[model samples]
Target: MAATFRRAMDALYLLCVIVGCTALVLISAIIPWAVFTRYVLNSAASWPEPLAVLLTIVLTFIGAAAAYRLNLHMNVGYFADQLPQPFRKLLELLVQILMALIALFMIVWGESLVEVTWHNTIADFPFLSVGVTYLPIPIGGLCLLLFIVERIWLGIPPDPIPAHHEVAPFE
Candidate 1:
């Protein structure tokens, strides 16, 4: 059962990575186009800048969740590492609890925010709801919550396998 759950989560993690990377690439591409249209082409489109901002929000939240799952999120663990084994373990639990709390806060507040803004359309995009842009917050929070719960229950997985192109020292 645990193995099955982990496999499912691994798939979800891959999905997060795909979404985040795609958003990031889109942002990179669109920003340049926006700039080109404004300075070079002498005609700026209203949608690109706002669209880039929306994509940025998506990239940040989704990428952050993926980072957390991969244990790539930033932390100051030097002191924690120096502590005795038991103390280190306790500190780990404490940290996980705090993370869980933050995720919970995001879930509650983010949903409220989404609800409040759902009816309002974005200024530049008449058909799009402002709340749609805010979706990453709550969705990322839920993803983070799932990962935190899994960590609390089964502990963090080992580092992921390196990509094919990565150099191996012994090779």
Candidate 2:
């Protein structure tokens, strides 16, 4: 059961990474194009900014889930690290509980937001429902909830991926 859970979580994390990276590349290209169209061509594009914002929302939420699974989320461990082992463990548990609560809040409120905005359409893209834009919120929260459960009930994730090879800068 544990193994299956881990495999599932890994797959989810990989999916999030792919989505986030795709969004990053797309946003990078779109912004420059928007700028060029606005300044160089003297005809500002209407779709790029709104599209970029949507992509950013997706990237931030999904990337955050992946990062949490990988233990890449920010940590201010100086104070906690100074505590004794038992206290440290307690603190860790406390943090996980707090994170789980936050994830739950995201899921609950995000769904409400999505439902409330379901009938509305993006200003620039009238055909697209605004609710669709908010989907990443609950989806990411779901992913995060799973990861937090795994961490609290299962165990710490393995170490970070090791570099495949060392490259010399001069080479």
Candidate 3:
């Protein structure tokens, strides 16, 4: 059971990475085209800028959730690390609880935000709902909540890939 759940999460993390990377690549390509069209071609393309902004939203929320699952999100851990073993453990648990609250907040508020804006459409892409663009907020929140549950229930899982390796600056 736990193994199955872990496998699902691993897949979700992979999906997030792929989507985020794709968005990044698209943004990279789109921006240059936008610049080229405006400067070199002397005819600006309107779609590129708006599309890149939308992709940035996807990248930010989805990528953040993946980072959180991997324990890669920013934190000030020096103080937490200095505590005694028992205290440290308690603090860690507290942090997780706080994170769960934050996730919940995101889910609830994000959904409301989506609902409120569902009828509205983007100026650049009239077919695209503003709410659709906001889907990542709640989706990322849900992913974060699941990861938190996994942490509390099973403890942190081993990273599928090593997080870091030593590299010489010029070698």
lDDT of each: 0.89, 0.91, 0.90
Q: Is candidate 1 or candidate 3 better by TM-score?
A: 1
Inter-residue clash pairs, candidate 3: none
Candidate 1 structure quality by residue, lDDT tens digits, 45-162: 8889999999999988888988998789887889999999999999989989999999989889999999999999988998999888899999999888888887888788666887
lDDT of 1 at 114: 93
For model 3, how does the per-residue alpha-carbon lDDT over 81-118 read when each residue is reduced to its tens digit?
Answer: 89999999899899889999999998999999999999
Best by lDDT: 2
Q: What are the per-residue Cα lDDT tens digits for candidate 2 across 1-171?
A: 999998888888889999999999999999999999999999999999999999999999999998988788897899999999999999999999999999999899999999999999988999999999999999999989999998997877774575556444564
* Model 3 weakest lDDT span, ten residues long: 162-171
Rank candidates by lDDT, best first: 2, 3, 1
Clashes of each: 0, 0, 0
Estimate TM-scores for all models: 0.93, 0.93, 0.91
**Residue runs of model 3 more than 4 Å from their true location after superposition:** 163-171
Error of 1 at 106 (Å): 0.9
Shift in Å, residue 8, candidate 2: 0.3
